[model samples]
Target: MIKKRTRIVCVTLICSLLLPIQSASVKAADNNGSELSEEISSLADFEAVDELIEQRVDAMTDGDMSEYHELTEELEAHGCEDVSAQEVQELTGETSQGLLNSQIQSRNNISVQTKGLYSAAASNVTFSKSITNVSYGGKSYKVMKITASPKGRGTLFNTGSVTQKYNSSIKAGSLNLLKIVAKKAGSASNVIKLVSLYDTVCSVIRGFKSTTKVEGVEANYTWTVEEICSFIYVYDARVKNYRISASYNKAKYVVSMNLPYLKVKNGKSYSGITHKQYSDWISAQNYGKTDKAISCFKQGTTYNSWVYNVSMTGCKGKNIKNVYLQHPESAMTLGYWN
Candidate 1:
């Protein structure tokens, strides 16, 4: 009877202990979950900070310094110090940001490789990384902030520039870039060498040769950048004025001087839509054309980029064939708070 009693008491004690332990474990899990949620919430604050900085910079010199000044105070609280107007003048010898990297790059995604143009030069043109101070209505605020890489996009190879590079960067079989168009160097003599990079034998590799007649005209197949380069190397010089169109959908740079400042995203030509088509879509979104290093200053958003739409001309000065090398088009989405 005593043994039985002891056993019952032990079992009850064990059960009692386990109940608290189990409850504690669940509580720990809840605590951990709460911490994880808090961390995720904190990350969003950084994004908010970046957006606020963009807005502050945009309104720095709009004939009223109160807003700009208020933004400066807010930035200072966030650890992004504003460079005084004196400091900016000392750097560029001009009022406002003469030409800083931050001024040209309004987005977080850069479209090309910048070869250290942020350093000042003898010329008035410059691309600095420091915050700028602008004055209006007898008041000034530090509008620009120290240049920073996008949330997680800091690398030597910028993804936004993949399309931009093909515009004038790729070298097929040539070493020297004598002409504006990038193609075979030295009469395309090294076509075999170029092909050897991809295949075992020095031979061109083509995919899906489609010769369809589009409205009575013989339309050749669309090709990738590599395939086109290969074709150019193995192309018969005798067949002059031979034309083909190749396109990829990704981000490419667009240039229009009509708008003082314009920002357009990469898009498909077939979609029949562009930031250009709508005035409401584009305004004051200025990304500098191209730096000395052929890099387009880009930031804010990630846009798709693949190169196409390139034109190479020859054929004994005959205008009969018009070969258009197209770049990749990019797709993007705009978010509205309302």
Candidate 2:
């Protein structure tokens, strides 16, 4: 009976020890679950901060000093000041960002035109570790702070408008519009007149062939600046009686061709010239006119260019044939005549 009683007591002791151990295990599990929940909550805070930072960056200017204050405040609030504006610029300009096999590029998911929060799972942006300086509205913000997680992840929020200032500096210039034209004559050898706005030739239209028919006559020719000028010089030589009336405006240059007392095959010889030949001649001359006009460009004109047009009537097909040449020069060079 004593042995039985001792065995019962030992069994009870064992049961009592096991009860405490089981309770301790349950408590540990509960603590672990709580920690996981806190981590999730921190992640939520991170996402909210990311959204807010993007909003202010899109609204600020990079060149303005005040922009930096806005960015710094945002960065401080979000925990991303590992680098500054100056640092970012310097790093970007580096030969290789001073790292072995490193690459830098804007995240594909990031919208270049708009600001938005980025989630780590969704974000594609990455950059090397570096220090940076930023000037905005007129001040610089130094290395404020840096944050890291036990995990190999980090976030940098430049809360100020200084980032925007940098962006604005990249967009400083403007564009202007221009037009050009060329004309040639009835006899292919006739002088090609280029009526243009400025004197300097920015560009030229070469190996151009335009065709048109006036009821029954056909005309064609290769058009270029050099050829057009050469045609004009030829016409001045062949027809001493020929006269040119030209004028220009800010937007257009017009040349009205009028050669009087010509020997028309018949007064009806106007029909023999054909509309196509006249149009071809006018087109050839317009290119030369454009070259000449380009030379007149002044300080403000340097950026502006020309739209040129050339037209003529009362010239014969014999005259047109002489004006059109197979190849006028080896390589067409504009402004060479000047």
Candidate 3:
């Protein structure tokens, strides 16, 4: 009787374990079925969207307004009401209106014959063109007449010209305009302004110096405009035979010669200077000199650490050199001075 009781108890325990295993298996099967249904639905949606896009492409290529409206209705019925013309073009490689305009500009066979180079001060420059046959929309179209004008920002020293390539077949005796404006490339004034700004900054750097210890030796030197512009400053303490390395904020325009100084300690340079610390140091300096330097140019502005906005008025003043001497300590500092 005890053996029979033991057997019944074992069977009950086994059934308890088996029940959970059976339940887990059923749950897993349910999850898999749900995933498969979602996947199938997603695929169906994709196929429907693709078909609608193709229909739109065909309609656009054929210029068929009726077919385009029919496709739009079908797309709306399929819950794709938010699909746009741009989206359809993106999916099907079909050309949008902007793309059509770009194609006309890039591929049109139109040549301009100017009497001479267009003058900046001239109100208008008349030119004639020989228009060749262009293949567009599977039809050969020839340009009949073109109306040209000035199109871009033109200063008294620089000018822009516009040329139109037209397809006369669209409307009989009327031009279907394909406008292409080309600007004359010249910045004689900007070059002059840049030269003047560079000369002023160099002169300022040449005159300024700070009495400070660099790499454990006293040095009477300050960072140059070029070094600051390059975003790194290096000077040698010739007496100590050690090199000093410090980085400055190039964007500040008038960077301070002091603060966050580094020295070569035991052949390794150490500094407590963070980027924010150096920037703050620069911010404390007087910008009067920098502002004066920039004012020497017509349209001079500081854009960032790397870009300086310098405009050209005209090259009239004598050119001055922006020179910096490479320190002898530069050779020992792993090519940092350059």
Candidate 4:
């Protein structure tokens, strides 16, 4: 009788142990089934979203308005309403509008609206905590939601908007527009103004006295043909057809004129002249009492009769020397006299 009682107690203990194990196994199976269903549902949603995005991308490429609208509607139905494929392209840094300045203004407006929506809808999205259940289709569906910070939202909006502007500005020939706007926004200390001075110079030079490019360093500022012509007259000691030079004498600046500009000039050239006449004419010139002018004329006498005549006759009352006329030419060389 005692043996029979011991067997009953042992059997009861064994069944009690097996019962918890069976219950645990069933609970684990249920958890696994829930996880599988959630994964499948999430994957299906992702596929739908991806397919819709692809269709919209295609529609946009084809410029099909109706198809684009349908794709947008489908995305809206899937809880992504404001995300445009075109906007996405801009945001992703793939491309931008053709005009940068206009694009910058437009992007700012879009960013403001997008930030407002993102801020307003953030509470509906999940946070850092794990989400065990999601409400969808009148049934509890497991979902995970992520929320972004205001700073992050601001960053996203700013980066996307500026990138669009930058790319568009490049297309519009406003290469430094970003730096300019950044200065306006107080985000940057320096503002750059990009003026294609080459274009300006080219335009100016095109109307100059010469078609061949001028032989000199380009000016930092823009210039008109007249201003440039004056510059050549004033600073270009190498210019032909014009007598110009600078000299200092007795601590006073003197623009000695050797050319007969107003007929009040006094310089001596031999009355009857040949090559020896040219050399004698230059040697007798008394335009300035300076040793340099005497030396210049003496050295200049060796040039041909054309140069000698230009120096002696053409530059009679001008602050120029005979050797100065022998300098290189930009326009057609004022042909030498026979």
Judged by lDDT, which candidate is best? 3
lDDT of 4 by residue, 295-317 (tens): 33234421111111111111111
Model 3 spans with C-alpha error above 4 angstroms: 1-44, 83-338
- Alpha carbon deviation, residue 147, candidate 1 (Å): 2.9
What digit string (tens of lDDT, one per residue) describes model 3 on residues 294-336?
Answer: 2222132221121122211211221112222111111111111
C-alpha lDDT values of all predictions: 0.22, 0.22, 0.23, 0.22
Q: What is the C-alpha RMSD of each candidate to the true structure, in Å?
A: 26.6, 35.6, 34.6, 39.9
Clashes of 2: 80
**Tens-place lDDT digits, model 2, residues 1-338:** 24633543455456446432121000001211221111111101222223333332323212343654564454443334333323322322212222111211332442422122212311222111211222333643111111111111112111111000010111111100012223323223333343211111112212111221111112223212111111111001122211111211111122222211111121221212211111122223233232332223211131111223222211121121111111111101110110
Tens-digit lDDT track for model 1 on 54-155?
444334313346765665565444334433323323322222332333434654553433223222111211111222222334643222222221111121
Q: Over 4 Å off in model 4, which ranges?
A: 1-44, 78-80, 83-338
Better of 2 and 4 by lDDT: 4
* TM-score versus the correct structure, for each prediction: 0.19, 0.16, 0.14, 0.16
Q: Which ten residues in a row have the lowest lDDT in candidate 2?
A: 160-169
Candidate 1 lDDT:
0.22
What local lDDT score does residue 121 receive in model 1, on the 0 to 100 scale? 17
Full-model lDDT, candidate 4: 0.22
